[model samples]
Target: MEVENEEPSWFVYLVRTSKSALYCGITNDLQRRFKQHQEGKGAKALRGKGPLQLVWSQSEINKSEALKTEIAIKKLRKVQKEHLVKQAVRFDRK
Candidate 1:
């Protein structure tokens, strides 16, 4: 048996709901979590908000940092969250 050495990673993500609302969360497996949300099996606020689109994801973070970041983002108003997402997009393009 062989063990593959893969660095653990945490991510903070934002998704756009079918109704155009934003959803934010933290996950070690962004793809899986995103799929769960899209399938209506994730967050209660996200259920029935199908056709979700992953809009922003921040990687290279640890669990603690991710949790704190998630908490901070969750506390933001809708406009503030939108600003955060825009910042992420700009950062990614750099």
Candidate 2:
């Protein structure tokens, strides 16, 4: 018998706080995770950042890819992150 490796679907997301700050995270369910963040039950860094707005999300990625993408995005300068979000939003709308 062979065990097959299965990849979990994951998403890389960014939320903007009322203070105009960006938060980065990865989740299998973006909507639920965002709700938890809004409810102050998610990441401690984001707990007080409400009302949080889902600013960017990339889907159809596996867990590993999502984590790598999240780290890469987190390391970007704010301007670069903003540019990335803008670029992603443009593609999302298409």
Candidate 3:
């Protein structure tokens, strides 16, 4: 048995729904997660809200940071999230 030394890079992502709503989530596998969202397979809130777009994403973060950042972003108002998307600000920090 062996262990891989490198850790998976987690990401905090914001998706824009067809109805102008933002969905926040964190994943180590960004591509796969986004695919699930697009297919309406993950996040019940986004199931009926089709045509999602990956508006913003911050990469190269650890799982802990990604989860924390997702929570913080989820707590923000819509306007604030739009501002974040507009700015594409790097908010994840140690």
Best candidate, TM-score: 3
Can you write out model 1's per-residue Cα lDDT over 1-94, one digit (the tens) per residue? Answer: 9987656598888999888899889899999999889788899999988789998888744798778777877887898778877777422211
Off by over 4 Å in 1: 1-8, 89-94
Tens-digit lDDT track of model 3 for 1-94:
9977766599999999999989999888889999999988889989988889999998744898788888888888899899889998987434
Residue 63 lDDT in candidate 2? 84
TM-score of 2: 0.81
lDDT of 2: 0.81
lDDT score, candidate 1: 0.81
Give the distance in Å from residue 6's predicted Cα in candidate 1 to where it truly belongs: 10
Q: TM-score, each model?
A: 0.79, 0.81, 0.84
Candidate 2 Cα errors over 4 Å, as ranges: 1-8, 89-94
**How many Å off is the CA of 67 in candidate 2?**
0.7
- In terms of lDDT, the poorest run of 10 residues in model 3 is 59-68
Model 2, position 13, has a per-residue lDDT of 85
Model 3, position 87: C-alpha lDDT score:
99
- For residue 37, model 2's alpha carbon misses the true position, in angstroms, by 0.3
Clashing pairs in model 3?
none
Report lDDT (Cα) of residue 42, candidate 2: 94
Q: Which pairs of residues have clashing backbones in candidate 2?
A: none
Candidate 2 C-alpha error for residue 93, in Å: 21
What's the lDDT for all of these models? 0.81, 0.81, 0.87
